[model samples]
Target: MNVYFLSGLGADKRVFSQLTLDDQFIIHHIEWIKPLKKELLSHYAGRLVAQIDTTQAFQLVGLSFGGIIASELSNIVHPEQIVIISSTPTGVPISKFYRGLVKFLLLSPFAAPLLKSTNSLTYKFFGADTPELKTLLKDILHDTDSKFLKWALIRMSSWERKTRAENLYHIHGSADRLISIKLVKPDVVIEGGGHLMVYAQAKQISAILNKKLKSEEY
Candidate 1:
């Protein structure tokens, strides 16, 4: 089976560099496309569906904001399963405080630049503790498109799904600061893992994924 991987907000395929899966499964990374002005999340997801080869059997694996995109895509395309790492199954996980904050930032002229800048606060929020991890985080942030970041943040803030997608598997990090564990009930919880746990705890997460992806049950 083929598995399509979607990276977090403003991130690329590098986010899944550390993950290892069985030889039987082929992996493909879904690249982010430019969003139309004021496009709805559902419509944006519809645009992304052009990248997938739906003729064959496949699954989806998304991280952070990409997870939400995966959920939206699931509604449009039929995937065998979808696994979201360090992410929530529904929009309820995004609190009202975060929504208000995004709205406030959208009005500010400095929002895009500020969000694209790599800083100590960004490191702490992403839990980039190791030197290599910090550098990777910095590079990802530096390379992110400011417009896309702002647009994604706005879409995330207003996402309104109330139920989980079918055959969806959620893996959360207990120590994730950006999305608190208290906000969601995940299928698998990585203890001491942070927002970047997919990279930091690749070995453990990879093992879990291999098992889940290979199993008959979703």
Candidate 2:
């Protein structure tokens, strides 16, 4: 089986480096493309799907923003299995107060300044509490384009998965701060693991994929 892994927002292929899959599967890393000016999430997902070879039997494993992209891509091809890690099928739930604040930022050009000020909060939300993680996060944030950041933030805030496909599986961490675990029904729950569980619990993800693949093959 061929497995395509999609990384989270502002992250690259390195996020899945820790996952060790069996020889039965070939892993492909799908990178994110810059969203076209004023592009919708569905349209962006279509572009992402175009990067894949849809003729083969494959599995999709996505984390965070990639999970949402994978969910949209799943409508284009029927993969043997679809696994979402550390993400929600429905958009992340926003509190009433936060919703207003998000709208204000997304609607104004001052969004970039606001985001810069929240770098520390972003680090904590993504489960990067260590000094090293904080430094790495700062670098990532610095490299990100402000326009793209604003677009992604608005996209995430407006996203809604009204209908889910069958055979969809979710693997989430109970301690996720970015996306609420309560909003999703995960097949597996890793206690104490946070939003970056894809890195912290890669072996467990690989094991789950192995078992699921074996079952499908039989």
Candidate 3:
């Protein structure tokens, strides 16, 4: 099976480096593109459809904001299945408080640098406890484009999708501070897993994927 992966907000393919799947799965990483000013999330997802090889059957795996993008893509392209890790299928789980925060950030001068800075707060929120995980998170944050980050934040905070695909499988962390488990009900929950559990708990996630993806059932 050909599986296309979408990384988190402003993250790259490195986020999925720890995941190991069976040889039968051919993995492809989808790169994020620049969003046009005031572009709708659905429109942005439609633009992304160009990258997918729709001629053949494929599955999707998304993380964080990427999962939201996957949900949008599912509306445009019919994939065999969708596995979202540390993410939600709909934006209903996002708190309205974030919308105000995004507006404030856009107006504040310190917002750009603050969003790019990887500090203890960022670490705590992301649950990057280990030194290696902290470093990786720091690098990812540093490399993220401020404009893109702001754009995604605005779109994500205001997203209003209320439905999900029938073939969608959600995997969430119990301790994820960013997207609290209390907000949404996931198909599978990883104990002690946090926002970065896809990296920290790769072994467990990989095992789950192996079983879930191989099964004939959704």
TM-score on alpha carbons, each prediction: 0.95, 0.86, 0.95
Candidate-wise lDDT, in order: 0.90, 0.77, 0.90
How far residue 63's Cα lies from its native spot in candidate 2, in Å, is 0.4
Better of 1 and 2 by TM-score: 1
Per-residue lDDT of model 1, residues 93-158, tens digit only: 557888888788776898877887777898899989999889889899889988888888898888
Which stretches of model 1 miss by more than 4 angstroms?
93-100, 215-218
Which residue segments of model 2 deviate by more than 4 Å?
92-100, 113-120, 214-218
In angstroms, give how far residue 189 of model 1 lies from its true place. Answer: 0.5
**Native-to-model Cα distance after best TM-score fit, residue 40 in candidate 1, in Å:** 0.8
Q: Give candidate 3's TM-score.
A: 0.95
Per-residue lDDT for 70-158 in model 3, tens only? 99998899999999999988876546687787778775877889998988999999999999999999999999988889889888889
Q: Which pairs clash (backbone N, Cα, C closer than 3 Å) in model 3?
A: none
